[model samples]
Target: MAVELDPQLMDILACPSDDHAPLRAGTPTDPDADVLTCTSCGRGFPVVDGIPVLLLDEAIPPADSASTSRAGD
Candidate 1:
């Protein structure tokens, strides 16, 4: 099911990363993923039971971030 977060809350929600970018509902990869994706870093923070888990440890980093880090090695 699609998560329905308040528009006002969404507007205030920011990614808990160094970028601290604005977050939007769901992700670019999956619109119904029940998570909020960062506009800058593209990390996806899962929403559990209507509560947003914004911790960096809980965030699913963008696929490219993984590959890019590996490529640098």
Candidate 2:
């Protein structure tokens, strides 16, 4: 599913790993990417279905294999 961001929500959202100030909407890895990143923590949060999966277990480090959130699968 594709995640949509609310203009109001974007200003308040911050990285879970670290506040890192406001998160940037797009990264070099992706332009249409729904993930937002914390420059300080280096953790990326992927927003899906208009909800941000902020849980450490739910979030996966950017991978090359596929866009699977399973870190230990």
Candidate 3:
């Protein structure tokens, strides 16, 4: 199921990185896939079961195809 995040919450959400840029919502191809991307760093944070996993440890680094491809592993 897709989790619809509140616009107000989205507005307040910012990247936790040094850049602190605003997050962009992902356009999921699947119902269960949702993410928030940092505009400055290009890091991706997964959203599971309607909650965004915003932890820095859980973030996907920018331009890392290997990490993204192996995400399911």
Candidate 4:
């Protein structure tokens, strides 16, 4: 059986670098299809090996390299 994720832990988990918006966990359709979407930025953060990859590049990188990347900025 899969371990039940701690609600409080999930509750406290915002976009890795973004604290302004909260994350709402979703049910993965496929075992490998894991993702957490940011409501504010409309970016999908992926979860791999039971870990959520919350970096912007992890979801979608800046249009250009010059953009000093920050989460949901």
Candidate 4 overall lDDT versus native: 0.57
Candidate 1 weakest ten by summed lDDT: 24-33
Ordered from best to worst TM-score, the candidate numbers read 1, 3, 2, 4
Q: Write the per-residue lDDT of candidate 4 for residues 1-73, one digit (tens) a residue.
A: 2323577777877866555577655423322336665556545676676777777776743224225554338
Error of 2 at 14 (Å): 0.8
lDDT of 4 at 8: 79
Instruction: Find the 10 residues in a row with the least total lDDT in model 4.
Output: 24-33
Candidate 2 residue lDDT tens string, 1-73: 2346888887888776645456666554675677776555556677776677777676556554344545458
What is the TM-score (0 to 1) of candidate 2?
Answer: 0.60
**Clash-forming residue pairs, model 2:** none
Which of the predicted structures, 3 or 4, would earn the higher lDDT when compared with the native?
3
Q: Which stretches of model 2 miss by more than 4 angstroms?
A: 1-3, 18-20, 62-73
Candidate 2 achieves a global lDDT of: 0.64
Cα shift from native, residue 29, model 1 (Å): 1.6
| lDDT for each residue of candidate 3 in 1-73, tens digit (9 for 90 to 100) | 4447999999989999887999878633333447887878877788887789989999976656557778878
Q: In order, what is each prediction's RMSD in angstroms?
A: 1.8, 5.2, 4.6, 7.7
Task: Tell me the TM-score of each prediction against the true structure.
Answer: 0.85, 0.60, 0.71, 0.57
lDDT of 1 by residue, 16-62 (tens): 88878999887887788899999999999999999999999999989
